[model samples]
Structure formats: structure tokens, C-alpha cells
Target: MQWDGISEFVYVAENESFTRASKKMAISTAQVSRQVSALEKRLNIKLFYRTTRKVSLTEEGRVFYQHCRSVLDGLDAAEHAITNLHSKPQGKIKLTAPVTYGEQQVLPLVNNFISQYSDIEVSAYLSNRNIDLVDEGYDLAIRLGKLSDSTMMAKKLGKRTSYVCASPRYLEKHGVPHALSELSQHSCLLGTLDYWHFSELEREKSIRVSGRLRYNSGFSLTDAALKGLGIVQLPDYYVEQHIKNGELISLLDSYRAPDEGIWAVYPQNRHLSPKIRLLVDYLAEKLR
Candidate 1:
């Protein structure tokens, strides 16, 4: 089967107009019509019912359209793989990540990676809001949570634990909460969610924590916690060095928060591009 002809037929069927399909395919309208006609002749089927106003697919055309789509998709994948072999994975790779994670963890590695692979260009966006990878044309994203999209592929890089922490000054004044239930008694810095999820003695738990101070940004919440204002539940990355330095002490050690795993995610593709694969592997190795 002529893959080019089949591809042209699929485009025409999708557009329902030879002129529109030709514009999309960057070919002459006459060439588009010729290719579709050639494909129909080869298949020995009437692929479309043409009219003055518009074109509609015949019964045989619907079946041929499905087959053409599959065949053309396979051909495109094959061509991309072959082209990738000759290419040195040189292109702009757009990535999205949480602000704190991107700034503290990913930024350092990106600098090193770019230095090593001078050909690869990277653009990293640090934002907490979920982005539409396909719509935005992002090559990859580092996501930290449960993935809800079945359309994308994700590789687990590592697991992260949260810590309920407060400054020594706050602990000295307000005292510490020995039990998870006691968290409500103390002032707390809240994030987007008013409740904190945790686990204790093999059982899961949730605590409704309130605070005088609240912020949507994690950095702001961390700063509030550092100022000895109230207790805050935050990821280990934000508080680890502080915990080590005794700037912030972990409270309620017996109760563990729900762990969130870091993942490198990308839109599902027939063949993974070398650039994305390399970066994902590099992150997994570095984080692990």
C-alpha cells in the first residue's frame, strides 16, 4: 500500500474538503485530489460521495478511512524513529514543574544537564497549577502526586514524605502536639487544602487544621512557618536542611503524612523520543 496516498486520504476525510486538506498537507489541491483518487483506485472502493457543497464518506470509505489512519500513523512513527537516529536530540524541550521543586531541585540539575548536552535546549516553567501537556505542546513535566490522566505516560522517579514542623520559638511558647488530634489546638499555616492527610500505625488519617495565616504559595507558607508563627505540614525537600539545622523541628513524628511520588510524565507516543527518554532517565537516576 502507498502510505503517502493513504495519509492523503485520511486528511481529506478528516477535513471533508480537498482544498482544506491540501492547505494542511502543504500540497496543491490537484495533488490532494489525485492522491485520494489513486488510493481509492488501488483499494477498489469508493471512499467518498462528492457533492457541490461538501463531501461525505461512503460505507466502504469509512472502513478504508480507519485502515488508512492506522497505516499512516504507523508510517509516521517509523519515519520519526529513523529521523531521530540521525538527529542528536537537539531541540527545545519544554517542561513544567512546581515552583519550589523546580527552583530547589530541578534547577540545579538542569544547569548541569545543559552544560553536558550543549545541543539540547530546555525551557522549564515553574507553576503549581496543572497544565494541559498536549494543548500547550510541552515535551515533558515533573509531577508530584497521583496522576489522573490516562492519556499520558508517567515514570516514578522517587517518593517524598511530608513533615509537620514548627520553629523552636513556636514550640517553646505554644508547646508541641503529641497526637495528631492535638494539631487543632495550635495555630497552623494552611495551604490550598484546610486538612492534612496522614498515616499512623498502619492506618490512614485526616486532620482538619486551621490557621490565622494562609497562603496559596508553598514558599509563603514555609516562610510563615520559619517565622515561628504556627505549625505547617510541608514536603521533606523544603524542610530537610532546616530540620537538620534545627531551624524547624519535626512534630508528631509518630503520625506520617501520605507520601507523594515524583513522576516524569509525557504524552503517550508510539515511540518515545530520545530527548525525553534521556531526560527522564537522568532525573530518575539523580533523584534516586
Candidate 2:
């Protein structure tokens, strides 16, 4: 029988995490993952139930793990943790993200990751609806803002700031709003939400805003603001450069809401495969 991945498998079984097992054995998580995967392949049986959030043994995997642990009672544990760093990560990773962010930011990062790991394949679905990972068989999802209380695990990839802005031409014609209350007097470009979010005196606040035009698209709303049609509130990604070049003027600086997290969320007990885990880390690093 092949002995290549037994130690790695044992460690992962015990710790329920490739990352934790790697640290305990002083090896790369990639090595731990690769070994376990290799062991499963050699045995022609699945070893672990994998999810990005956690890992657990399957029935056959449990039996194998138990057998390995007993055999290890008479063997050196370190001897089982073999070094195999030559294997390139290769697998399919299915994920979902919000439409605009996926198009503008996340998919680009995924492209870079695929460029590095040519053997890995990915399928990304961009939608605003909250997809059930386990039910729909999605491996992971990118979510924005505050996460609701849930059993699912999440990692903050980065933060996004929202800006309330209007074209200088609009501000000049209508007079700039100096206080939150003044927003009522100006036409506000609308999006999916009828209210704009902000912070006032250290407390979160939302103010209802109405406009001559309402569209679900950020680009459309931004265009309306640039054309001096009205003011708009949107995440910085949509307006930061425009503000920088003086196409739009930031409003109520003191009332701007705190930045919200961009997150990578996955189902519990469904541990991320090595390839997906690698992508998550790459996304986190690049996003940071």
C-alpha cells in the first residue's frame, strides 16, 4: 500500500482543518491538502467531507483514520508527514458574487488566479440573490456589508466605502447641501434602495431620497449625477475616480457611513477543497 498521505490524512482528521493540521505538522496547507487528496486517490475512496468552513471524516475515511491512528501508536508521527511540494493545485471551484462587484473586481482576481494555476477551473455566477451553497452546490460566495447572524463562516476580503456625490455643475446650479436635511430639496438619483445610508453623531442613519429617475444600475445612476440630473450615493468603486477628477463632488463628509466589509462566505461542515481555499487566500491577499 502507498504510505504517502497517511500522516497528512491523520492530522487533518484530528484537527478537522487542513490549515490547522499544516501548522501542527509544520508544513504548508497545500502539502497537507495534496497528501490527503493523494491518499484518497490511492485508496479509491473519499476520505473527508470538505467545505470551506470545516472538514470532517466520512464513514470510510473514519475507518481509515482510526486504522492509521492505531498503526501510528507504534510509529513516529513525524515520519508520516511526508513532503510533496511539487504538485500543482488542480480542481474545479464554483462560486458566486454580486453582479457589479463580480464584474468589476472579483472576476478579475479569479482571472489572475487561473492564469497562475492553469490546471484549476472556475465557474462564477453573478447574482444579487442569496444562493444556498449546499442546496445549490455552490462552493463559495462573495457578499457585501454586514453579514446576518448565521451558522455559515465568513472572511472579510476587504471593505467598501459608500459616497454621496453630485456633479459640480448640479451643485453649482442647485447650491450644495450643507446638512442631511437639505437632501430633501435636491433631486437624488435613485438605485435599488429608496434610502441613502450614512452616519450622524456616531449613529447609523438612513434618509429617504427621491429623484426624477430610478434605475437598478449604478452606472446609470452615476451617469445621471454626471449629467447634473441629481445626486447619488454609491460605493466608491463606482465613483472614486470620478470624484478624483472633479466630475463629482463628495457630499456631507462628516456624515459618510463607515466602510462595510466585502466577504467570502461558505457553508459550515463543507470544507473548501485545496483549490478553492487557495483561491480564497489569493482573493483575500489581493483585495487587502
Candidate 3:
């Protein structure tokens, strides 16, 4: 209800110095001091304990500061909402994703999104490691597979199906794997992971695999598979086109693992800004 001295009082309380608050507000120190004094008189409360060296909040001031800070934050949010309503979604959003998927799938869509909303900018970090969006100050993150962080709020952007496949030349030369056990007989192009996932009788399974070519890169593994170096188990993005073109043959369809969820996750504790929310919706629509 009382707005006259609230801003100046809050500024001084938060900064714990009238001079600093004056500088922040672009006002004179005497004005800052007068406003806060008037606020204390109007409220009939001692808000600050001042000394020659330091100034700090009193018990009443601490309580007032808590509520005042929330009010200011709410006002900021309201202002942002009004601005977004009047204009197109425009802001920088920083996000993270696994390297291969971001490069092959997510980043291209992000490019398309930025083209549509030219005022918006995106900073995407492509990495395999799980990033703490809140701790790292990222607006969003695209993650794959079964999610382990129950604390994160996620939207299912899409699904990624893994394919167990080999080039026609490799299949012809090394013989096709008719059963899960037959994978051991052929040369397997390896990635960072040594285990190939599968599903058998409604149960998920991870079979340990080994090979001569090992790279943390999915593109390299796909190239190795195309060159007929060995069979590979990779996400469909890496091999689906090749399978459709008959350059690579999909194998073990009967035991293929269930499609893993591709998710866009943000800290559950954080607010979803309009730009980020729109971006998430846009991605889900395109991915679908």
C-alpha cells in the first residue's frame, strides 16, 4: 500500500548502506537516507541498526526485506509477462545436449527455430555429461535415455530408437547375426559404451561388447559401419537412413531395445520463461 519510500528502503536494506543504495538508484545519498527515515516513521518500526562503520537490518527489517524482495521479484516477472505479450518471444536461452544428438538432430531444429524467431538467440553446449541446469545457469537441457534425475521437470520431446546394424558388405563377408549370441562372432565397431542394449521377453538387457574401433563419437562409429569395418549398435539417427537405403541392414529386430525418451529438462525449481516455454513447445511439435 505504501509505495513512497519502499523502493529506497529496500535498496538501502539490501545493500546495507545508504550511499551504495543511492548510487544504485542514481539518487543522492541524502535522498536515500530521507526516504528510508520517512518509511521507518510511517511504519513506526526501527528497520536498520546504523553505526559509523556498518549498517544492518533490525529484526523487523529482516522480515520486511524478505517480503519486499519477493514483491520486487514478482513485479519483474509481471513486467516480463507484459513485454512478452506485446511482442514475439525474444531472448537468449542457453541449453545443453549430448554431442551427437545435438549435432545431428537437436541443433538443426534449433537453427530452424532461431531463423523463425530472429530476435531470439541460442547458446547450446554439446556434451555427453549430465549438467546441472541450475548450478550451471542453463535455461534448458536436452537429454536422452531413461532419466535418473527425478528432481528435474521434463517434457518428452521425442523418442530415440537404437538400431543394431551392419553394412551389407560386412554382413555379406562376416555373415549376418541371426541371434543375439551371434554378435560375438562378428567384429563389432565399438563406441564409448561397451554394452549394447536390447529387450528380451519384456526385460531390458545390456550385453557387453568389444571391438577394434573405439571412439566416443557416434559419427565415427557410423562411418566405420558404412565402411564395412564391423557391425554397430547406435541410435536410429546414426543408421536409419542407411537402413532405408539398403546400405546397412537392420538386425535383431525381435530383441531391439524399447525406444528411449528424448527429453527437454529444466530445473524443477526454476520458472519457465515464455521464450523457453515456446522453444520447448516448438521442438516437441517439430520432433513429433
Which 10-residue window in model 1 sums to the lowest lDDT? 267-276
Q: How accurate is candidate 2 locally (lDDT)?
A: 0.88
Ranking by lDDT: 2, 3, 1
Q: Which stretches of candidate 3 lie over 4 Å from their true place?
A: 1-83
Superposed model 1: Cα runs more than 4 Å off? 1-81
Query: Model 3: which ten-residue window has the lowest total lDDT?
Result: 266-275
Could you tell me how far off, in angstroms, the CA of residue 19 lies in candidate 3 after the best superposition?
A: 26
Distance from true location, Cα of 23 in model 2, Å = 34
Q: Show pairs that collide, candidate 2.
A: 50-271, 51-270, 51-271, 51-272, 52-271, 52-272
Native-to-model Cα distance after best TM-score fit, residue 195 in candidate 2, in Å? 0.8
lDDT of 1 by residue, 1-288 (tens): 456587678777877899878886799999999988988788788989999899889999988777766676687678878888778877778899988899988878888877878888999999888998865778888999789886677899988889999999999999989998788799999998989988888788888989898888778888888899999999988787899999999988878766889998886542457776788888898987
The alpha-carbon RMSD values of the candidates against the true structure, listed in the order shown, are 5.8, 10.9, 8.2
Candidate structures ordered by TM-score, highest first: 1, 3, 2
Report residue 222 deviation for candidate 3 (angstroms).
1.3
Query: Candidate 3 on 1-288: residue-level lDDT in tens?
Result: 778888888778756789978887899999999988999999999999999988899999999987886787688678778877868787899999998888888999998888888888899999999987765779999999889987678999999899999998988888988888888887888887888999999999988887899988888899999999999999988889999999999999999999999899997545578889989999999876
